[model samples]
Target: MAGRRRTKHRKLVDKIKEDQRVSSVPDEQNSAAADLPTELLERILSPLDLRNNIRAAAVCKSWQAVATSVRKSNRHPWLMICPKVGNSYDFYDPGQRETYSLDLPELKDSRICHAKDGWLLLSKARTRRIFFFSPYTLELIKLPKLQSVHEAIVFTAAPTSDNCIVFTVNHVNPMAVAVSTCRPGDDAWTTIIFENQLPFVSGICTKIVFSKGRFYCLSEPGWLGVYNTNNGIWAVLSVPPPKCTEYLPPDYWWKGKYMAEFNGDIFVVYTCGAVNPFVYKLDETKQVWVEMRSLGGMTFFANFLSSHVRVDLKGKMRDNVYFSKVLYYGKRCVTYSVDRDRYYPRKQLYDWGEEDPFQSVWIEPPEDA
Candidate 1:
């Protein structure tokens, strides 16, 4: 009886141990054993960035269909210009939950600006190489040698009668307006140089802008000029009211800006602790410029110390998202954005970093609000 009881006890313990071992196994393994169907894969791949979506499509047939459809719809994809981190800019397409990281092996110590019509201009300060990126389809165009001076090179593309863009480079003290073409991957950059010396390279950012195939320039002590690209003609522009840049009543916070463009028209917003910013327009028919009415009243810097506006447009801007560097994050530059009343402001966006993002523009993530 005792032997029989001992054997029964051993059997009970062995059964208990087996049950414990089986229960200890992970649930994920069992779920994986069932295998993911096509429905699950579709759910997983959508909502990624543009670059990633492209790669995912190449993996198989089913994924390819999803990526192609999202791209065809023309939804805006988030583009990131990170060089030291790795090669190529990271394009994130939220419409399709996917990311495509294109390889840019030539990018070393390069600074990148906004992407216009899929081509992004990258300037490497050293050897003067312009690596172009077709951010949409991962197409890259490497340009030939050009002047790699200290001045930051800005990029803009437009559709015109000639169907080519004018590439202009300017420093703080505007020197010569060096013009290049709209072709991103071209080696030959022909110059339509400015004949005159740029007045102020040391003072604030004196600049020249192109709008509707017409180029307009801003100089010191309230000087503005317009350039015609088609005929290579140039002329002077009128001035806004001069301000007392010396004294501030301690109640005002305004930093004046020369005429900036919003939707192919010229505008200048003056500040002397005043919020009623004014705008001017280039009357295309009259061949003259006219100062429009005050836009919105008194706007000041939120930090109360630095007042700078670095303006650029975002995706298909019908004057919608206007990008600015209003929020400086303890670096040489800060970025911020605001909406203009009744004005179709293009993308005025900014992306700031903890350290001096060097000259790279920082765009804020959408959910920060």
Candidate 2:
């Protein structure tokens, strides 16, 4: 009887241990999630925004593996500002109407020259040391020192790319402009000077944009200066502004000029204080500027600080040109209808009569951030 009892007790103990082990196993749903294939998981997480995607990544190891695989792209442009009251900068999303703050000690002392693809080209006071930084990821890349590039700078692509090219332009004189180019891995900058025979004023603002694998420098007097990145040749292009039957007004040449690429074509925009903005497209084959009556589905955002960028018509922001009204004690955000020739002033970005000193810039946050 005692032997039989011992055998029964051992069997019960073994059965209890087995049941406990089985109970500790994960549930069906969790097991399925953990065993979910990476391909399907990526598809599920692909539509999440940067913030939600981060939360999804923290769910579990399998979710993280899949979240990291989702490609980052299709980012909208955000407006960035560094106010005088704080060390952190504010990023405003136009679509969401939300603002995000990022702590960047590097930007406190440095000045921003250019912003694109979520990367900022920052220069320290007078030392000529430049750094490319991503505010989202806090990644930093030191660029070659450029002492003469205080006017305009442009990058062909993201600084993380191996074949990226950076171009800088400095107006040297009334008739001459100095340009510099450098690759990401280069320690020094290559300088090129383009001088025109005709004399003009020197202090006029300049703008640069990268399109069709070349750098287009739009300078004062409405000239398209072309620098072929592949061939390393510089060409000065003179495309006369719209024919003025009457004597051109004083603001004719003094108007604000900017360049933007839309639908693979480059355009020059002329904005004056009280006149309707003008648009001209480059007829590459004929080497002339063709007046554009309508922008179709494109919109333009121009401010006092950065280059003009092309924004596709979406929702309420359609077929309009947006600019900041910073004159006459005004700080209004105004949009112009290219088709209707009307100005619609939206809410002001700053308080009325308060002079905001920071240079406003639009930046496309990196997808991979």
Candidate 3:
């Protein structure tokens, strides 16, 4: 009786295995897709914008299967020039490790800023006409033009997560302040205007920059204005280090080299051929301005406006206060990144040997993944 029961159990197991094998079938589409060269396939898809690239992947089972795999790649994010082509774009995704280009409607000729999240700010690089969209969602938002802004250049001074675009406008004069952004569903640039003469009467045309949550600008009148983004008001109230009575022409300031923001604070380096350059910090909470001190941890910021070290658009750090580099220079037109941060000290992010700065270096937005 025991032998007969064992035989019956063995037979049952064999039958189950047979049935399972018969039920499964091969996916021909996926199998065929696996045969194509991935580089060739990516080259085919790489020109599409963030939106239609997904759409092309959804075309057929074979293409979809291949495209799906392409989308999963983890590429490092990079900063690249944005192109407005074919009434659309063929952007390269540094994060994908490979690029797939797709169509972006209504973006032709509109200037584009860096990609953030999945969205791009589309605008006339010179005028205020602007729009925003996510290449993944195919959602487009139009913005209201700043009535006061007749012409402008887009500046991404806000935090990486914010979609708002800022620019200095010629409006009627080419040097006023203007801001615009797409608030979710809005279809156009929502323009904001700021105007007030410099407070103390200095001759510099200071450009506005965003650090933390405040907008800072040193006007031609030699006054620094701190505008709070949340409140939309200028606290142009505090004044420190009075301007010299010896009057210099307004053009003398030459739009001070951008104030670099690091670890949530702003530091503007003063480097000209004429005056001993010093960095000043704004204590927005207390409404006061103070020069960064050498002993108090900010000493590398030493260059005067009267020296050759101060050129058209060049600067350096005098200490570790701005990420710890303590020194940097513009050799190929690009300001070498010198992280004063305690980690890597003055490591080169990009290098071009013996090249004229006119063709080699440029300031750029930090890449966001």
Give stretches of model 3 more than 4 Å off. 1-122, 125-127, 131-144, 150-184, 188-206, 241-250, 274-277, 285-288, 293-369
What lDDT is obtained when candidate 1 is compared to the true structure?
A: 0.43
- Tens digit of per-residue lDDT, candidate 1, span 1-369: 999999999999999999888886654454553355656665666665544666777755555765566532222323243645766654333223244455766555766633334355566766777666544444666666775342333344522113545354443225444444444445577665554433422122344456776766554444555567667665554443234323334333123443445456565443332233334455656654464443332121211111112222223232222222222221112211224433222233221112233333322223321
Estimate, for each residue in 1-369, the C-alpha lDDT of model 2 and write its tens digit: 999999999999999999988886655556778788787887899987645776888777888878767735334566777667657887766555566778788676787777776788877876878888888888899987886745566687779987688787676777786768887779889897877664433332656777887887766556667788888776776655444212335645644565676556787666654456776788878877887778775667664345455543346665776653323323334567778866665332322112232356777755653
lDDT, residue 194, candidate 1: 59
The estimated TM-scores of all candidates read 0.45, 0.69, 0.40
Q: Is candidate 1 or 2 superior in TM-score?
A: 2
What TM-score would you give candidate 3 relative to the actual structure?
Answer: 0.40
Instruction: Name the candidate that leads on lDDT.
Output: 2
- Give the residue spans of candidate 2 off by over 4 A: 1-75, 173-175, 195-204, 242-252, 308-313, 324-333, 346-358, 366-369
What TM-score number comes out for model 1? 0.45
Candidates 2 and 3, the one with greater TM-score: 2
For every candidate in turn, the CA RMSD to the true structure comes to 18.4, 15.0, 16.7
Candidate 3 local lDDT, 1-369, one digit each (tens)? 999999999999999887776654244554565567768877777665434556878656656666666553222222222342354333332212233345655655665432333455555756656665555556776666644433323344332334554543332232344444334334554556556453333122344555666655554544566656677665455565323312223454443333444455555554332433345565657755555544232222111111011111112322332211122331111222223222123244321111221111111222442
Which 10 consecutive positions of candidate 3 have the poorest summed lDDT? Answer: 303-312
